[model samples]
Target: MDARLNYFGNQLGAKFLKYINSAGHALGLSSLPAATQELVKIRASQINGCGFCTDMHTKDAAHAGETQLRLNLVAAWREATVFTEAERAALELTEQGTRIADAAGGVSDAAWAAAAEHYDEEQLTALVSLIALINTYNRINVIVRQPAGDYVPGQYA
Candidate 1:
């Protein structure tokens, strides 16, 4: 299937993506754990139903040596026993953050406190940034009806 628009071919879309990719690069250098970052991305993408992102992140995680068991369990993280407490907190925050509109009060204080307990201030900053950033990507890809399953690991890097 073809995308509605060739985002990379369009000059304006390319320019916008350049900045978005720059922001993503900065977040990658933050103190947040790499594994946790990928997990958060995968989970948020799943929740957003962005097949392009879900395909990309899951493939990226696998190529980075993440176990299939954990990757598959991300969607059902609440019932899974494969994740650490810190990861669980991060996942919880990702869910609440991604579904912000669904919950009238936004991210709950309890979720915030739980995540704060596990992550440092800098890590928290990165987490919030990552969540917001992934959501943006999800929206773009979904709107454009981007096709999935052809992403190669480190293709953008």
Candidate 2:
């Protein structure tokens, strides 16, 4: 399928993407675990139906040594036995955060408590920021109908 517009080539969109990508870089430096970061990114992309992002993040995850079993099970994390408790909490938080528009209330207290149990304040801060950043990328890519399956790991690095 063709995209509605060429977001990369457009001057305005390119400028916006550059800045947003910078925000992601800042979050990448946060205290959150890198494995959790990729899982959150990939999960959020799937929820948002942002194929381009899913492709990018999954490859990035694999390149960083993420096992295929865990990657394949992210979408079914509630039933999957692959993730740790900490990772599960973060994934739950990512789901509620990404689907905010579909629910009246935001993330559940139980979910927050679960996350708190696993992550320190600094890590929590990074997780929140990463969630927000991935959602932003998802929206942009979905709106522009960015094509998927051509991403190379660390292409943006």
Candidate 3:
């Protein structure tokens, strides 16, 4: 299916994307674990129902050697046993952060404390930024009706 607009091709969209992508690149260099980063991206994309992002991050994770079992279980991470405690905490934070409107109080202190137990200040900063960044990307893709399943790993790199 065709997208409503070629967001990456239009001049204004390209400029906006350049800035957004730079933030992603900075997050990539952060102290946050790479696996946790991918998992957070995948989970948030799933919550947002952005098929384009789900496809992109899952593919990117796989290309980086993420296990198929783990990738397949990301949506059901709460019930899954393959993730580390740190990863679980990050996922919980991602869910709360992504669904902020659903919870009147926003991300709970419990979620933040759990994440704090697993991550350093810098890592937590990256995780928070990553969540916000992925959500922004998700909204853009969903609004533009971006199609899924054709993304190659690192295509935007």
**lDDT of each candidate versus the true structure:** 0.96, 0.92, 0.97
Candidate 2 regions off by >4 Å?
A: none
At residue 71, what lDDT does model 2 achieve?
Answer: 93
Q: Which stretches of candidate 3 lie over 4 Å from their true place?
A: none
What clash count does candidate 3 reach?
0
Which candidate number would show the highest lDDT if scored against the true structure? 3
lDDT of 1 by residue, 1-157 (tens): 9898898779999999999999999999999999999999999999999999999999999999999999989999999999999999999999999999989899999999999999999999999999999999999999999999999998989
Put down candidate 3 lDDT per residue, 73-94, tens digits, no spaces.
9999989999999999999999
The sequence of per-residue lDDT tens digits that candidate 2 reaches over residues 79-142 is: 9999999999999999999998777788888989999999999999989989999998899899
Model 1 segments beyond 4 Å from truth? none
Rank candidates by lDDT, best first.
3, 1, 2
Clashing pairs in 2: none
Against the true structure, what is every candidate's RMSD? 0.6, 1.0, 0.6
State which candidate, 1 or 2, has the greater lDDT.
1
